[model samples]
Target: MIALLLALGSSLAYGCADFLGGLGARKAHVLRTVLVAAPASLAVELLLWPVLGASFSPSAAGWGVASGAASAAAFALLYQTLAIGPMNVLSPVAALVSAVLPVTVGLLQGEHLGTAGLLGLPLALVAVVLVSAGHGAGGARPSRTALLLAFGAGAAIALQLVFLHQTPPGSGVAPLIVGRAVSSAVTLTAAALLRRRLGPEKPVYAVSAAAGVLDSVANLLFLLAVRSGDLTVVAVITALYPAGTVLLARGVLAERIHRGQVVGLGTAAVAVSLLALT
Candidate 1:
């Protein structure tokens, strides 16, 4: 139950972060937005290090670096895919793949689920897809390139979570700190390389920074949740983040919530209840 709550918190944080990040990206280049966000994320992890305590064991460091690289890849690929999107299809495809990969890995690693969990997991996956379904007027279908990038992004996201889960329990928040550092460096490097292409539009610094903070919080929560819960359950629950994003878009942006998303929100609630009962 505790793990379920933590995972849900992670989902909420992730959703909010994505919303803010998207807003920031609209004002500036994606890489420019990331320039502000990545360092802010690293700063949050650094602050947490003192409170949470950390041990930079070699295993932790290695896994942290791996997760960091995966995170950078995920960020870049996902943004590019969205830029080239038929978003309604690509978003759900990425979300579903991210959830499915982690769940599969968890099961392969010997995690077992109760019957309720088994049922809930599939429902949760479906909910992720539904919640991510965009209500935008029809656009051109995504190119094959966009589809491939979406798949790559999803796989990278899955790897990030899986790698984080591989860290030793005693490592504290060291892995996160290390991962954030690496990711920050990668983001900066990419920004530098693309500076010429980045337009003159000023970034929404405050929004981007807030997004970073929330993203850090989300990662911290996910790390804690996975340490205490079955990875399969935690991953599926976290993947339901799109529901939170949809709700925020409705409440904050006054965007219309589509019928599928409304149904998805209900399905997600039921799925969570079933998982909690296990």
Candidate 2:
């Protein structure tokens, strides 16, 4: 239950981070947004590193870097998709895919939970899809390109999560440091390859930087959760991040809430209770 709460908290933080990152993307190039977010996360992690007094193994750090590489691609694509609009379509695709992969892997590995957690799992997944559903104006058919990018981002996100849990126990925040460093490098190279300029509206810097901090923190929470809880539960719970993101937009931007999302929200609430009963 403690791990589950941590994962849910991570989801909220990640939702806020994605919202801020999307806001930044609107004012800057996608790669520029990534460059800003990654390093800010790295800097914050570094400050926490010494406090943790953690040491690392080459193998663990390697896994961290591998996770970072995949997440860099995931984040870049996610930002690009957000910048293009119609998050209604792409967000669900990414969210569901990210959750499903880990759940499937856990099931295959013979992982199980209390009966309540089991019952809640599929409901949680269903809620994730509904929560991401957009209505009316944003509900227009997504372009083929957007669908493709979202698919890639989801896959990368799943791979990143898989590798993240592989880091040795008791490594503290070491994996986070390595992952952030690797992701920063990957994002910079990708930016250069695409010829995306770092120079953008100065105001975007603060937003992107804040996004980085939130995102990095979320990653730490996720790793902690994975270390303490079942991967299937953690992944599925965290994947509900879109719920917070959408709620934020509704409150801040006054975006219309889809009926499906309202249902999803209620369903998610029930599912959490069920999981907790375990």
Candidate 3:
């Protein structure tokens, strides 16, 4: 029960961080966001290093780097998708892919679901879809490229989850650090390729940095949760992050929530309850 609660809290914190980081990326350069955010995240992880009491392992480090790179791409593509596509189209697709991929992998590895887990799956899927539904007001409908990128982001996010799940407990923070390092490299390369300067935008950087810290902490907690419990349940609960992101957007950006989102949120709560029962 405690592990489940920690996983849920991590999910919400991650969602909030990602939401703010997404906004920061929109207001500033993507590369700049990564550059500033990665270090901030690293700092937080390092601060918590003592409590982690992790022992270093080369394999775990490798997994972290891989996880980091995938996540960076996921973030970049997701941000690009949201910048141009309708929220209804991109957000849910990406979120669903992220949730499904890890759960699928866990299932393939012989992770059997209890009855409650089975009930949670469809509800979780619905929640992702609803949370992603945009207010039917202003905004251009999704473009072909934007749609493609959204799915692409989903794939990358899925890869991130799988890689994180691969890391064993007590492998140290090296995995997380490696992931950040790889992500930093990937984002920096993307920035350079786009001929965009890494700007000194303090306000945007500050927001991104704070988000990075939360994100890093969430990653650590999630890894711990997965190590301590069933991967399927942990992944499902953590992937409910879209709920947090949607709630934050509705509150801060005055983004109108469609009825779908409301339904999604309600369904997600039920799914969480089911997972808790397990």
Best by lDDT: 1
Q: Candidate 1, residue 23: CA error in Å?
A: 1.0
Q: What are the runs in model 1 whose C-alpha is more than 4 Å off?
A: 137-140
Q: Predictions ranked by lDDT, top down? A: 1, 2, 3
| Number of backbone collisions per candidate | 0, 0, 1
> By TM-score, who's the top model here?
1
Q: Candidate 2: lDDT of 213? A: 95
Tens-digit lDDT track of model 1 for 166-213: 999999899999998898899888888888999999889999999999
Give the Cα lDDT of each candidate.
0.91, 0.84, 0.80
Q: Report clash pairs, candidate 2.
A: none
Q: Cα-based RMSD of the predictions, in order? A: 1.1, 2.1, 2.4
Q: Lowest summed-lDDT stretch of 10 residues in model 3?
A: 194-203
For residues 1-278, could you state the per-residue lDDT of candidate 2 as single tens digits?
88899999999999999889878877877677777788899888889888864568897788888998898788777767755657778888888999899888777778888899989999999998998777734547778898888888888898888888888887878888988888888877777877745564543888899999999889989988988988899888899998888899999889888899999999999888887776
TM-score of 1: 0.97
Ranking by TM-score: 1, 2, 3
* Stretches > 4 Å off in candidate 3: 136-145, 193-203
